[model samples]
Target: MTPTRRGPKKIDYVGAQSDGTKLAADLPAAVQVPDDAVAWTAVLGESTVRNLHSPDWKTREHALQAVMRSLGNARWNAERSPEDVWNTVTQLLDKALKDKVAPLYYASLELLSTLVATYSPNLPYGVLTQGLEPLMPTLLHRVGNNNARIQETSIQALLTLANQPALGLAFLAPHALSAIPKKSQSGAAAAIQMSGRLELITCMLNVQVQQQMGFGTAGRTPAAAAAAGKGGDALMAEDVVRFTRPALDMPDDKVRTAAVRLVAEVYRTRKAAGQPFEVEKMVGAGLKPALMQRLA
Candidate 1:
């Protein structure tokens, strides 16, 4: 009888080869790649970054997929070093986020959100500090990006960045909004924009209270639990009183409700923590006046 034919051994297969020299043979003849591909990250990472910037959407999609997969692989610890990943991909992300192609921009933002969620503590100090701190001004500028999808995406990115406490407080401080002068009038085109911003800030205040209460996966520093880092302690109220005026004065119903909820959440958390709070007084003093001003 003739000898039975047998399938090729698994070792002979070249797909996603664990070793390099063998895989190299499978690449197209005209495609040039580095010889030391066993160093997977070095070989594919640069190419992946390049593909993200390529004009073709297919190329960008494949590159983003490759990056997503690499971020999950144990052998790819290089991506965990946030500084290195930032250096490799920052320019590409900035361009892609601004790309006319919606998918490209959305995917780019997803990558950043992933970086923040997965690599928070490990992210490079200088990169996180230098890169993220300047984000609010940039985001405020881009608040009018292509449309609501991009605007919402920008807000999500900002929230993700705020997973870092210091970064979060940097933007939430009243000083951050001090630049936008208070607008008491309505019917101006800016009213619509103003409403959206007030709603966003209200969301932030609630989140800060949640984070401080340990209801979140992470939280801000203890100083966040108090109101003062200044003076002889007369004005240190353990809450941001100055900003309450703007939140209450916001003409939007949702904005006022959010502002009340913010105050309520702070009251709830402080009570739980055994810290003193004057909910009635703050409401009477700040909210009542602003409500009257809003109606009148």
Candidate 2:
């Protein structure tokens, strides 16, 4: 027994071949975006865009909604052409806007937001400007929808649109002066509460990043620095007065928490910069106490 010692066999993972031939470990996957029309046609047909718009078959409507929801994951690979993908998405969005079914419409908006997140910024602005703008009022109405999920999805769509500065300003400019009066419905309140928190946090971080980078300085090498400064200034000036103040006083704890965090971040940034910590001036009107409590 002492004389018998068997050593472990060394397995070469890299060198191991499936057959007699050498394996190409780094080879790309075989399935790719086809240049031909067949693949896209199949995707279009399978997406049930037409069926979702049909007035008949309630079950088809539901099924189409689910398919639209899942469409976000279908094009994960970079094989599809941007034009083809955008066309398909725009078609789906068009049908969704026309559909009387609320679920289908919500799913479509969710897919649109996913497209914004996943795709390059070079996507046709016409789609957003022409197609989406007309739908904004309807979408805003849906933000107070009875269904919590629908309302949330609508908020997400708005936030996604807001990522594009031109689109954001266009959409907001009209409504910025108008009051975003609280909805009578509880579901709408819940949705606004959730979405407002997310928007506030994003805005705060954006301003902080701009401030850290010294955005407006002439010595900055990147042209984007000056643009960032201008953008940050605009966001703080507009949002602090409009969105942030309202959010700070929201009835929901989550909304208040996010508003507080934003106020605290702004206060800290200004303090560090030797700028006046004018909490009252920043928050405006009635939110000083809540903002102060959060900062403390």
Candidate 3:
């Protein structure tokens, strides 16, 4: 028999270069920073910023990211003027607002957050009042996104906006207020109360009472109010009293415990502010025996 023709031995291809450089090779090119980037003269030249909004997604993203990074760097360096960055940022934000793409929407929020953190001095109050106002409704609608990063970023952006009193009030207007309680129930009640979302404050207080009484999550009542800071303390005491009274009456040990915590926080807040303590009276009227025994 002809020397048996053997199939070629399959060589196991382990070699010094086994690690794949192919992925690196296949990666997209790094975005080019135009020579004029970050130059105030070039940035403000007529039609400079407008060109940044061209249909190229990568370009828009690069421009926004570069502007944010430069703003941060300038803030750190203290060498660059803020006015230039502010103008460019506002122009980029305008472009982002006009774009219908989801990525651009999300990027606009990121840019806004950076603007808030870095260039508040240069950013006009009117810009925050008008330009940023419309974005909140859009963001509130996206809070349920399966992307946790997006959800968290949106909440953080809202929180950042709320740090300013005027913007905070604008944010609490009906539409944004409606989104807080829809979050996962685990933190929903606490977040609503802490956010000073008065519309849902009573409901959250009741939940906190339930939790404190061992009916639900424990120790969340005062914790929620404390998280709200002074803004929450300003919520009418009558509302707090109204919500906690039923829990004060419940025979359930956990409910009683929770109610006591809620009432105490209200009274504490009022006392701290040198205001009348009305929550106790409401509790007494609604659950006389329980208040006398538990809260007294």
Q: What is the TM-score of each candidate against the true structure?
A: 0.56, 0.48, 0.41
Summarize candidate 1's per-residue lDDT along 61-162 as a digit string, tens digits.
668767766666666755355566554445344444444455655676777676556554665444655554333444443332426666677666666655
Q: Which segments of model 3 are wrong by more than 4 Å?
A: 1-51, 73-91, 94-106, 121-124, 164-175, 178-296
Which run of 10 residues does model 3 get worst, by summed lDDT? 11-20
lDDT of 2 by residue, 89-157 (tens): 664555354444454465557667766555525454455454455455555555545456665666667
The candidate that wins on TM-score is 1
RMSD of 3: 15.8
Error of 1 at 109 (Å): 2.0
Clash count, one per candidate: 1, 0, 4
> For model 3, what is the alpha-carbon lDDT of residue 180?
38
> Which candidate should be chosen as best, given lDDT against the real structure?
1
